[model samples]
Target: MNRSVPMNKAEDISRTWLEDFAQLLTKTENVEEGVTKTFLPDGWLRDLLIFTWDNRSLNGLRKIACYLQENLPRSVISNIELDHHSELAPKYLPLNDTLKCVCSGFKFSTTVANGHGFFRLVEEGPGCWKAATVFIMADSLKGHEELGYELGVYGGHTLSWTDVQAERRKSVEVDPYVLIIGGGQTGLNIGARFRQMKIPALIIEQNNRIGDNWRKRYPTLTLHTPRSYSPMLYQPFPKNWPLYSPRDKIADWLEQYASSQDLTAWTNARAEPIPVYDSKAKRWSVTIIHDGTSIELHPVHIVVATGMLGIPRVPSPTDQNIFKGVVFHASKYEGGKLFSGKRAIIVGAGNTSADICQDLVFHGASSVTMIQRSSTCIVASSTTRDDLLRGWPEGGSVDIADLKAAAIPFLYLKKVLTEHAEEAIAKEKELHDMLRKGGLNVSFGTGGSGCFPLVFEKAGNYWLDVGCAELIGSGRVKVKHGVEIAKFIEDSVIFTDGTSLKADLVVFATGYHTMHDGLKTLFGAEIMDQTGPIWGVDEEGEARGCYRPSGHPGLWFGAGDFYYSRFYSKQLALIIKAIQIGLV
Candidate 1:
């Protein structure tokens, strides 16, 4: 094989390889063997509702073979053509500036829908360039492709935008095909996707405003992720947007997002405490209450995007009945200035606790103490943005960034990030040493992944250091580790280790139950038990019970960060559309 030309021009090599690969896929007998030869020994294949109406990641020969053997006969992937668009042209993209991959995009079609994909290949040896990862994402179903933005009128001044909007609102309000229960980023993104796919969806927000979920949090709160990494559907922040947006700024963006998308949303509306599902009709009977009036509606699908957890898990102290100072869950505690000139004791050392501690120090709290029941995973905000958000470059298209991030399977990414986390700690040894010297317990993340995979795991147990770590390291805030709260008194709080701290305000930053557990009241214990696990990863490291079939007809769950919501919302929409149309 001639290697000099291939080495000199990665694009030419990729073009030739893709042509052969497309031809290889035509013959059934050669397809499996071709995949084995083309991909690395531990290559990854991430499928977002292309092969089937589900999100899946395949690694190694066994999973790939089994998946293809089961679904390939039915999926009948065909019309594999390489894309020649300038933006998607074959090029050498670097991974962490260490490994080079010749990447190219392609267009294809499955039995159910049409799709596009990107393949990243690396030079394995002298003449072998093997695929490191291949990502296939569904673009549209055969008949349910997202409609273009076209004026309703062919010849102008006759159509009223207001009337059209009202008609759409009434149609969905009367009998929505999908009902989303929260108006936060997750719910908003899901509703936006449904809107684009022409699905009748109504978003019920319990708060008085669409963005209140973010606005109600403590002031001075800012997002830890970079601006390029945090964006709503279809809209990128202006070039002048801040690197780290404040909470209120984000809240305003969410409020604007719903309006811009023209989504049907009801603020200050709550679905009934419990919904009754009619199995025969395949619909859920729910009532939305606004102010005092109630309206009955029957939606075929119900998406519980309220949160990862709805109920707060505040601890009950034994002696709280005897004497008490001001005590409340962290959610209820508005701001640190409210507790000015008063001693504060906060239980838990996760993100919320860290934020509260930092807020109190900035404000005039007489003293602040944090009770860390267990060690915490800590990484600087800047380090996290650089380490986890490398794919999301400044002034780049978010679509490409999302595709690149989703290319690697979760389990493989977890292993890679763990190594990066270890390197991060070693590099920031001075900061960690000071934090330990000041008595704050720290864990580098679950399995030492630097808390990158925790979003797919427990969702808590980590803090992205903003300014609180510096304050803690400098002894501005006191830390009490390895002790649980024994009881609370009128003037002081006692610990199980027989230590007591004088306190005027106590805040429980303790986390809540798992998302599935939070649904017991709304879904009832029986149905909740039957549903699949909501947030954590399953054996294959794919997110369970979210953006996929929830183990029950007409029920779905939407959860995760902005990045998670942005990409998976489409996955959720595609599967739901397939189900509704009887195409799956």
Candidate 2:
């Protein structure tokens, strides 16, 4: 088995190009304490290099020169290989060609180091080439072998497990540098990132146990995305894990992750009253109630990782109190078994609504109806796994996939997805027609961007169909499109369309209010207003009030899906670290 053979001509060229780039990068030198310089000329880099660290575009030449000088070690690059497929195609003109490559190799950085690089090369002349974009990320200087012993009891004087637990239990008395609110995926991820940066962070979860957020969801609920796209930092799910994990499985995984990652999380804890920020001290004084005991904590930074929809938004109908039935928000709906042999009306046509409607039908509900107020972007699970996640490496390291996903600019990715949406809708015209015929309203989402952008931009306008569409299309689950509940009548609901439907349970899957609303109770209305909206893309195409500075000092928001938290947690950690070190 000859391992050195190139898979193709493009791979050979890519490998050779990356080797040359690594050689030049290793020769670079630091010019100052935090800055560096390289001999690479101006034309050797792209105008805008996509940085995965914060998903920000940087001046390619300057950032690359600085990064290489600061991070690359002076050692010979070895075992350079094309990690993924690459292609050579014409660029700028017919005479100029571009070579896109992603490669990996090893270098000596205190020890044997691994690095992954994504490169774009352009033919400057017939026989001359220049780098259009060069993005490289290397492993930490410290190797696993060197740090592995620190994780276990190595000496007789080592701290006992009970003592360690006690220290965490008493963390409320000690002023931590950062306090994260929420024990969900976002908070856990931020805690992990802060731990890796050697920053003291305490996570306060209102639930009795970690991962209860997912555990409390409906039994039929499962992750819509594949396992490959939902890994925490440094720890990926085992290959034996389900492709689409169920609610309880994910809940258990999160609990194990928090423990395995050594993140300090105070469960069965609630932030009492509201946190008051002291301007003179530049710290937040927050009171927590745990197990009937009140504890105080003063932290320099407060991160609200309670998710984008931190507070449930249950709309009040004109005559709501008169309804003679069980009424609850989607968040409170445990399962459809309780509604068995009963008529149910689920308000809202989002993913949760769809899932609940299907669950109701499955649980032997006498009648189930979904009241759709607007069009929903519906994409098949297969399409999502096969097309949206097409180029993503299967069974590869999630960190690598995340970096690759981040390499593409958001707007550009949106455009690409828009085109994909158009093609997909065209291919599934019959499915769309069937759903429409079944009284369901569907769209390709805003600006044809489909479900991906809708998730970030609106958070509730789309749903990735996982057999629910089939149920709706087959008329197993009923849908009432283009209308709202005019009022709730006794033992029946009157719609805006002058129609009426009998119901025993009314579930409002009307989504939730922005995280800013949740902050209002914690911080005064003035401070909450200053924070602006939480989720949605900004002018720079990044998440508006997340992983970046909030107008209020020392306050940050960390919210999103698993992959999102995994990527942006580091960014939030870096921002806090910078503030702590006076680098901001």
Candidate 3:
């Protein structure tokens, strides 16, 4: 018997062994041929790879297999050793006298490359072992470079690069294969994926500039999630960027992403009427108002990336004509300075409600009160970063985290999250006690599924307490829980409990309508009803109406935060591409 190898030596041996395995995979007729049954045993990778590929359809898998075969190294690059610092490292099983290793690395060539590989191996007997599973990245073998000779010096060329760009910009009437509505994070992400797949796509934004959606938010707003959890596809934020990026910084990043990725977005353009889909031709004829001029486009597909919460849902309070105070939705609340020395009443108790209340307090509002229509799931921001997002730590690969997340079915994920939430709540008992004692309404969320599930299912039921919970606990921000607005009087709002409070400004943080409701004007009630509800877990445990087909032909919905968009954009692009190529 031999003693377990040192960590460094174990890593080296694993790397060399995996490289050999990679070479063996290249020589096989098919990448999946004889790899799993012969080398790897039944395990996580086996289940995930086979399930994903099989579910994607054999035709789709064949296309992917061809791509892998074309770019996988016929032999290992001798000069360049595999990246050993990958998250997967060999572990010593002393009790079993075995070494288990799971590893991944990338191999690049001049024109094409193998992007990533996931491998699992265990010591079968002494010096000999077999791979349990191996998953490799498929690369489309194509060169990505601009064709030119000193701008205008080439043969048959008369225009400079700038002139060419201007000409291209002028020709906006041309037909595109895919038309994406909303140039926000989701839109830009899918657009970038389409660009990589060589699929022609155009994004139409209602705002004059890209990222105005983020820019229009409150002045003190910053991303609640970490930078690693919220990155655009292909391009991540610079290393020096704040962990929680400010709103404007993110806005600027979106603008730069769209430009750098060369995504064709028509800003200040909006779809005028409901798009008419031709079932027979599998195309969408959309009329968009661009700079006050209507342009008709017949695109093969129309992706509604207008976000999960597209329309601000402002409840029309009765007796509105009597109230004299300023009234607006949370979306219209840009800053607190405007409400200085004024009593503010924010309706609803969610993340936005909490943030707005904190902002009003900071900006010297005379009195701020949060009306809690329902209990909110409250977790500390630190808890979210350390526990909920432990999978996506700083410096970890976002793609890897995404892949790992996708591997787990949402049903099982919900169970896992529920258990995690229970443990998390117990761990932070002091915080929960403080919140409860301070008269703040808190819950562990629906079925104790915590933040992620709540976001996916309800979209506005949870709040990751940054500082507002403390403010509420300390009475800096008053909490009026378990109540509903009865009606508005001349200068105050009366609660259902017969309590009246004077308010100079009323902010409704009641949240937005569903994506389906938001599309009623453009898609019409009939078409929208056919499309089904926007966000929620479907029977398949996937996000309803996203990445998968909507009920209507040639219509799709892409909505989620940065991670969700980045992770699922490939599936959306592949589906679109498959349809275009007649595979699906």
**Candidate number with the higher TM-score (2 or 3):** 2
* Candidate 1: tens digits of C-alpha lDDT, residues 157-232: 7658788788889898888999999999999999988999988999999999989998988887789999999988
> Could you tell me which residue pairs clash in candidate 3?
40-131, 40-132, 41-132, 274-522
Clash count list over all predictions: 0, 1, 4
1-584 per-residue lDDT for model 2 (tens digits): 11122334444555556556545644544432212222224322221111222334334456555644544454344555455422212112221133322233222232233444455444444434455444444333223211221555524668787787667646633768998989999999998888777678889899988999998887889988887788788788887988888999999999999998877888998887678889999998889898778988899998989888867888777777888899999999899888899999999988899899999998999988888898888887777777535545466657656765654546656766776666767866776787897899889877777778887888888887876777778887788988888888789989989999998999999988778887788777978877868888875456788887788888889888998899777667655665676645
TM-score of each: 0.95, 0.80, 0.79
For model 1, state the Cα shift of residue 462 in Å. Answer: 1.2
Worst 10 residues of 1 by lDDT: 1-10
* Most accurate candidate by lDDT: 1
Write the candidate numbers in order of decreasing lDDT.
Answer: 1, 3, 2
Off by over 4 Å in 3: 1-85, 88-160, 163-173
Q: Model 1, which residues run further than 4 Å from truth?
A: 1-8, 85-87, 94-99, 152-155
Q: Give lDDT for model 1.
A: 0.83
- In lDDT terms, how accurate is model 3? 0.72
Cα lDDT tens digits, model 3, 462-545, are: 888889877887888888888877889999998889998999999999998888888898989888888877888765456788
